[model samples]
Target: MEIKFNDVNYKTKLTDINITLNNSKINGVYNYNSFLKVLLNPKLIEKGNITIDGKVYNKYDPKVIAVIDKDMPFYTSKVIDEILFYSKIRGYKNNNIKEDINNLLEKFNLDSNILKRIGHSLSETEKYYIKLIANLIYKPKIIIFKDIMSGMDYKNKKIIKKLMEELKEQGVLIILTSSNSNILYELTDEVVIFNKGKVLINGSTNDIYSNIEILLNNNIDVPYFSLLTYKANNEKGAHLFYRKDVRDVIKDVYKSVS
Candidate 1:
């Protein structure tokens, strides 16, 4: 599945955007909310086109799913009812949906009893989890998560990371948008850096972050560990490698010092 944004211009907020996303890996789009709006709703693009598999894009595209920050309101009172409703509408082929829902609950660390509770009464985090379950039932080819990770705790993020890896193995295209550079570095295989509504650079996450000078020149935030590694190499004359985990960086620094 490929979504191509061809010369997309949106009323001065976005300009001449041309990017093609074809791979089924976890892609991190950095700091481009306006471009996201255009991708999700091509009607907002005043000057260009958004195509899915070389065809015109539409909201009803079956392969595309999004779990946004402002989650959809539950149509039914009970959480179970809401999930059932979504499964029914999305044409979920599983014969035993209740069993499937329970399995998802187990993976997400939610108790079975929570399904019987009122949907509106669930906490914000719980609501987000439910929404994700609803979308994952049908196994979309492309999934977009926008501005949703800043509030998640470490445990939640770990669960999500594992789930995303599983989805990637199943050939699901995942696009994650977050303000946290560290989160992106931890989760994304590819990174597309955007500045002031334009494509600044897009490439493999490791390569993009390794070029610290370009990011610093553009005033883009680099991952904390990457910056630390760069500073240690440049200022202290220490040879240290870039690492995602701070503990790994600490161990490497210690080895260099000793």
Candidate 2:
């Protein structure tokens, strides 16, 4: 499905933004409130004449998409039951779901016992993985993940990163949003960076992440590596992080010295 935003300006949310997005590539939008405003009202672009797969779509059709946020709570006694509820809501029948539940647990590296425990008692990763697994039951054509890495440590980020890769491989258009620049750099194919009420730039993940000055000027949290590379360039005229490789950074350090 392709979503086109044509010459759109919505109150204080958007300003003459025009972009076409479709397919399985991971796209990102950075900036907390801007991300929410866009995600919450995707149909708002309809006023500017939106089309899905080349046809006009005027109504709100969020069913074709699933927006996963960590703060969204599942109201169920047990974890497995909650998963079932969401799956059914998405049009998947029960029909012997035990094996499916088990598979999901294993896929997310979650313990089987969590399935029988309270839905709300699990850790952040557990909740996110469970919700994602549930969303997959009906196989949404598009999935939007927001703020899933807010409080995650580096190790947890890697784990979630692997899960994101799996999702990307599913042939679904994926849209992600995070305040953490590292998460966007690690998972996104392309990104749209917003400052205040307008888009600052829309570029490849590496390009946007490598633009340390612009990102810092907008007060966006930049990846540590990008910052290190920018500082290195200022100190030694060696643009190391632009290559976005740790080995390149080391090699640049050597060249700078000798």
Tell me how candidate 1 scores on lDDT.
0.82
lDDT of 2 at 175: 81
TM-score for each predicted model, relative to the true structure: 0.89, 0.85
lDDT of every predicted structure (CA atoms): 0.82, 0.74
- Judge candidate 2 against the unseen true structure and give its global Cα lDDT, from 0 to 1: 0.74
* RMSD to truth, every model: 2.3, 2.7
Q: For model 2, how does the per-residue alpha-carbon lDDT over 1-258 read when each residue is reduced to its tens digit?
A: 676666666667777776666665688878747445654566655246555677765565456778887888886778878878877665666666778777767776788888788976887777888887777666677778887877777776777677667877876777888777877887788888878767788878888877779878878888878888788888767756465567886787677767
lDDT of 1 by residue, 151-235 (tens): 7899998998999899888877788888788888889998888888789999889888877878888999999988988898889
**Model 2 misplaced stretches (Cα beyond 4 Å):** 42-47, 94-97, 153-155, 239-247
